[model samples]
Structures are given as C-alpha cells and as structure tokens.
Target: MRPPLAAVLGIDVGLLQSGMGGVAGAELACAVSNAGAAGCAGGYKLVGAPLSAMLDRLGTGTDRPVGINLIPEVVGAEELDHQLTQVLDETPPHVYVSLFGMPDDKVFDRVADAGRHLVVQVGTVEDGVRAAGLGAVVVAQGIEAGGHLLGTARRDELVAALRAELPDACIAASGGIGSPEEAARAVAAGADGVLLGTAFVVAHESRAHERFKALVTAAGESDTVITDVYEIGWPGRRHRVLATAVTADPDQPKKFIGKTVVEGKPYLVPRFSAAVPTEATTGRIEEMALYCGLSCSAIPAETSAADVVAGFAGVLPGSPAVTN
Candidate 1:
C-alpha cells in the first residue's frame, strides 16, 4: 500500500519548505527535495514565461516530489484563471497549493481529476476543517511564520485543535520552526509535518539576496515584524518581515503600479511584490519586503538545504539519517 499522506507527500521526516515567492526557486526546491523533504516553489506571482521556466527547472532538476504554492487572493480572478490555464497547459507543478483563499470549483476538480495533490493553507480551525472536508492537506500556518501570516493560533495550538477536530486529516505546522527540536515538537504536538521558511531562506542553494540571507543569519529572536507596509496588489495582508527602515514608510502607497526588471526583462507589476527581488535588482534593498520568521536566531551562519533536512531528520520518527 502507498504510505500515508505524509509519506506519500514526501513529508516523511515531518519537514517541508515554505515556498517563499522569488526565493524558493528551482535551485532551492531541488536541494530540499533531494534531501527528502517537500520543497514548494512559490507560484503566486509568476506567470507566462517566468512561470514556465521555473516549473521547467523544478520538473527536470529533481527526482523527488515537489510542490508549487499560489495565493489566490492576490492573483485576482482573471490573472488567476490565466495562470491556472498556463500551469495546466504548459507545466503543472507536482502539487498545487492554494493559500489565503480556497481554490475555485473548476480548479479543485481539475486537480482532483488529474490525480494531483492539493493543499490549502488556513488561518483558523474552521478553515482547517473546511480544507480537510475538501480532501486537501491542511497547512495550519501560525502568525509566527515568515513571509505571510496566515492563522491566528499558535502552531502547537493549531495542530492540536486540528487533530482533535479532524481525526483523519493530515495536518502540517508552519511558523517559528527553525531547528530539529522545533520540528520534533510540532510532530509531538500532533502535526504530521512541519513547514519551515526562515531556516531554508539562508540555505546555500536559496536564491535570496546575500544581504537578505546575512540579515537573517545575524538576526536575533526579536528582530521580526509583521506589517502591512508592502501591501499593494494584496492589501491588509500582514507579512512577517525583518524590522527594517522601509517598513517604517508612513506614506506607503495602498496600491502602486510600476515597471520592474526581472532577469533583464521589463515587467510591469505592483510595487513591493515579492517577485521584484532578483540578483540584478539594485537600490532600496532595505525598502523591499524582507520576509522572515521569528526563528532567525536558529539559523546557522552557513548551511545547505541537505544539512537543513538532516538537522531535522534525527528527530523524526522512522526517518533516515541526514547524508551528504
């Protein structure tokens, strides 16, 4: 028989990567997957050529199962439909994840019929229950998570509530998970898997800017802030970013339209969109959304994705050793 949902989803060690936008690209995704952890590529802001290239790399680079996360609320209906069409038509990710909002009926049915795994991230116990009912794995994201703040409950509380409420549902924990001990604690608290963002954000294979990674490495536990400063296409969404000068922008625009270059091509998008960050992008790095969780202190100065998976392996039940 196929293993339970956790194993089948490559979350056997109870570890997963958070698929941060512009950060969790192919190199990082492949590295995490090769380490036997589920790595999700952020697909919410990507479309057309850029989206296609990312999926192509993920598909060709790794033998392990991978996933792609999408935020339905920010993509808008027309763009969402268009992106979904491109994904299904060109190169669909191994798993399709919908965050902030549930997938529409057509997308849900399409994923189901295609035998692809679907995951829904919820902020509340009620939403978790709804995701379970829809046959999608429920990612119970706590406010401590980096990038986007999802649910209101603490990670442990959310896992316990979900386990108690939905006995058969497979629940994953996100937020404030940065070390093996943290991952173990989440599993012990009733989570089948743990989703880590900040830990891998500093991974050697990650595409995060050097300064971004350095800030995370040098940060302490008290360095994070959840603010709506970067709100543009998706307003009122509080994301956990490093407490930086840019977050202090009192006159931050509610909605901004601008042209930013990615990979040497001009792309028009909302300002502060996570995809705006690239190796070539310059100026105002501090002003950009510096996504991070509360666990920056737990990250070592230098580590690879494989080592990250290994760090948590020893704590997981029946998991293999972290090998080089």
Candidate 2:
C-alpha cells in the first residue's frame, strides 16, 4: 500500500513541490507557503551559521509546512544532519525529502522524532518500493525533472508500476512538469501531486540569475539537453540544462573536471567550467549550469509564483482517464 506521505504533510492529494535551486532561500520558501502552496528547500549542502540563518528566515516567513532536500552521500552529512535536526527541533519543518543516495530508517526515525514528515524522491519503481518498505510515506517520482532527474524511471511507465505496487503510498510526479495539463496528467496517472522546478525558476519571486531566466524564456520549445560532461558538485549524475557555454560550443577546449580534494576537502571544480556566466543572453549563457526541463517551451511567460500557481489552480482532468 502507498504510504501516508500526503497526510503526514497535512495537505490535500493535490500538491506542488517548490522548485527552488540557487534560489530556495527562506524568502521564496515562505512565499510559496503564503501563496497557498508548500515550500521545499534542498539545502543539504548549506553549511555553517548560514544554514541556521536560512532556516530561521524560513520559519519566521510563514506557518506553512516546509521541507529540505537531503542527499545522504554528500560529504559532511553527519554535520549537515545535525544542523538540520537542530533547526527542525527549533523551527520544526513539515517534512524532509531525501535523495541522491539511500537513507536508513534511522534517519527517518529522527525526522519523525521531530514531529515532521519524511519524503523520498525516487526515479524507478524498484526504488519506490524500497522507499515504501523503508517507511517513507511520500514518494517523489522524478522524470524529466530539471536539476536532478533522480535518474531512475520513465515518467508514465514508472508511475503506473509504482501505483500498482505501492497503492497506499503518497505518489507525487515530478520532472518536466511545466503546465496545468501536465499537472493534471500526473494526478490522472496515479500521482497524488505534482512537483515543478524549472517553471518556478523563472517566477518573479525566484532569485535565479537574470541571465539564466532570460535563457529559459528565450529557449525554443525543443531546447534542453542532459549532459554530465563538466559536472563538479554532484559527480556521476549529469544534469539537463539549456545549451550553455559550459556544455555547448563545439570548438571550446575540454577543461579538466573530476572529484578531488583540496585543503583536506574532497570535491572537484575545474577552472574552465567554474567560471560559467549566470545571466540569460550574456552570450556566455551557454557556458553556465542552467538546469531546465524539456517542458520549458510550454511555460506561458515569466510571471510570479502566485500567478503560475493560479494558472493551474483550477486545472482538472480533461481527457478521459486512460488505464495505466
């Protein structure tokens, strides 16, 4: 049976996972909650007092349920978890969604101890089943998602299989979801909710670099390619982004990139890919990491987060239900 991911978060079957990257600051998370939606922060990498500060702002911003995306495999996880636990103990987020690697139930138990929920993002049916088996109430199946694909399953096929296997778990569909129709389709396809990242990245409230926003707006319907060619932060997983200089430009020299350790630290960052531009059409746009989904073409315009939510607020099943 599907786990009680939705009920734990205290929301309806229909929901939205705030798509905040490089911009999931406290303000936006609270803004999402204030706008009749949920705010999620994937801040496992955030460190020092700044992490506490960010969580403090999020707590003070709104009374809505908030979540953080945690990848257990990242170095210094223990410290990060400690900080997260401290913040959750004080501010008490609504949930904690984890990915990138498997998290033992011991972690889930810790989240539950905070009186919070636990949601896990998965890419395949096998992973989903394992998540449910491990006591994760929420299952986020990401397909064509912007930042991290979860790299597991085909969106439609996996959704159907997961539904049949974990009927009781709260299933949320993510990846390449940019329109009301897609959101509705997720629900009709057995997903209890929808998670959008790229669509929100261009929102008025989003802090995404102006140059990046412009590129997302300017990208043709068919733009977006997933490549791990020059990755630094998370190795092994190539991300999808607009054709940028860091990735595109055939004549550009292949700069060095790989996992490394500096000053007792472990992580790789080559000079060439590290200096990518953040602006949209600076022409250097093609040289930076601008994660986006293939569905970006359907985004009507660069608008406010509230307006984007409102656009799909009334959307419902249009086409007759098709058996999965």
Candidate 3:
C-alpha cells in the first residue's frame, strides 16, 4: 500500500481549501486557511490597485501557505501585460506561478528574487521535465479540470508520465480532482499532493455566488461539459463548466468559442450563456452556469469546508492490493 501523503507543506491550514479565479476572495482565502486548510488566493482578474486590496485582505486572515495563481494568459496580453508585470512584481506570496506559461523568464526571475517558491502547471511531460530543470515545482493538471487545463496533452496519461521524470520536485495533481477519494487516487498514482479548485469553489465558505454553488450541488457526475466557448484566455484550452447556453451554443463549431480575455492562457472567455431571466431568478437553475469538473458528482449539498476536508481525507490512497 502507498503511504498516506505526509504533510510536509508546512501549511497550518488544511491544505485542501484551494482558491479559484472567479470565486476566491480575501475572506474565503483566510477563512479556509483558518479552518486548517491551506489558504489560497486567485488573482486572475486583479491588477493595478486591486492587487494591494487583495493582498491586504489576505493579510487580515490567517497567515498560512498562500498561493497566487498568475495565469500568464491574462497578464501576458498586449493590453494588460505591462500592468501585470508590475503587479506580479510586487506580489508578496510565498508561492507564485505563471499560469499557462505567462510571465515568462522575467516574472520567474522576480519571484526567485523575492525568495518565493515557483510552481508551474503543465499538460505535457516535456513541459514538466523542462520546468523541473528550470527549478520550478510542477503541477500536472489533467483536462478534466474546471477552470483551465494548462496542458496540450492528455491529463490522465500525463499525470503518470510526469511522475517518472521530476521525482524530486513537488508534484500536485489538478483537473477534475473534486473528491477525497479522487485525491487519494492521485496520491496512489504517485502525485506528491493534489490541488483542488472546483471542489472548494462550492463550499459554504466559498466566495462564489450562491447561484454558482447551487449549480455545482445539483450537478451529477455526467452533468458537466468541456467546451471552448466564452473563452478569451487560452486559445485551444478547454474547461468543464455547467452545461449552459454557452456550451450549448449550436454555433460552437462554426464560430471560434468567444474568448473574453486576451492572454488566452487556459480559458478564453467565461460568460455563461445562461443567466436568470430576472433578478427573481438570480438563484434559479436555468440562468446560472458554473465551472466544475467530472468529479462534480461526488460533492454533497451546501457542505462545510472542514467536513468536506474530512470526507476527502478518508479517501486517502488505500494500500496496493495483494496479487495472487
């Protein structure tokens, strides 16, 4: 049997409450960490003065291992690139990354100067090996994920493949890792740890809107769809969001999926095709669409982060089965 993943992350926070691009806020980041899960912060849309406010808020909360997911796709764009460069230059987190390979050498070097550990997300083993060689920890995210898939390769296959190469670097698995059992599976598959975005997005403490939470709660294993519509971040990258008018667009094939942002790193644009027809229906089902993973099936309704963490904690990789 594979050993239970020992906690060497130094994260006083649970390490399970990862933050999200759209949902992660100062309150959620600190609270989850205070609750014993590693607190994480997402800064995809944040730039300029907003960066200060975000960090200030995070400081108000617990001081656990905080992460700032810097998807190069957003900041690397021609329009926002400069501002992104400056904002990221000032970030104070212990961990940082150039999402979808954005920020490039300039940003990576800066993070190192600040004495921070950099984690790079990759979709291919080639990228993994290269990143490891560059001295950045690698996160092998699969395609079955919610927000963005940084890989151009197959997620499942890449997970096992990357393990063989970057043995010394810390490897965390993302993409469709929504449950404790799924986490255990990844550890069993040899991942040093797992980073779950969508799973925590639906938690009660999550800053995601109530409507967004409902969609995740009502969803089943087979309910979500992966598509390229409403994406302006990463060009060919796709994500699993609630099957709404956006993904349901019949014109998806004819028209390039509408990308909202320029960097187009992992997700392009993210406007849901469905929305409450009226303010009354804001929380209604038909109007709300959210990003989730294939692991959406295992989540319970409106649960607490601690309970959720406990549930997932039990799903640790079991001992390898004995052969006859």
Question: Against the true structure, whose TM-score is highest?
Answer: 1
TM-score of each: 0.88, 0.82, 0.77
lDDT tens readout by residue for model 1, 1-324: 213344647554656787777777878987887788788787867788888887788777777777777777788777777776766666544644545456565767766676777777777898888778877878888888887776568888988988899887878888888877787788778777777888988888887778878888998778888787776556777888888765766465634443446534776544465543545445556666778888887885868999888888777544665221
For the record, the alpha-carbon RMSD of candidate 3 to the native fold, in angstroms, is 6.4
Residue pairs in collision within model 1: 123-151
Tens-place lDDT per residue, model 2, 40-117, is 664656665656666677677777676666666554458657765656765655544444445665776676676666
Worst 10 residues of 1 by lDDT: 1-10
The TM-score that candidate 3 achieves is 0.77
lDDT of 3: 0.58
Ranking by lDDT: 1, 2, 3
- True-structure lDDT of candidate 1: 0.73
Error of 3 at 49 (Å): 1.5
Model 2 score (lDDT): 0.61
The TM-score between candidate 1 and the true structure equals 0.88
RMSD of each: 3.5, 5.5, 6.4
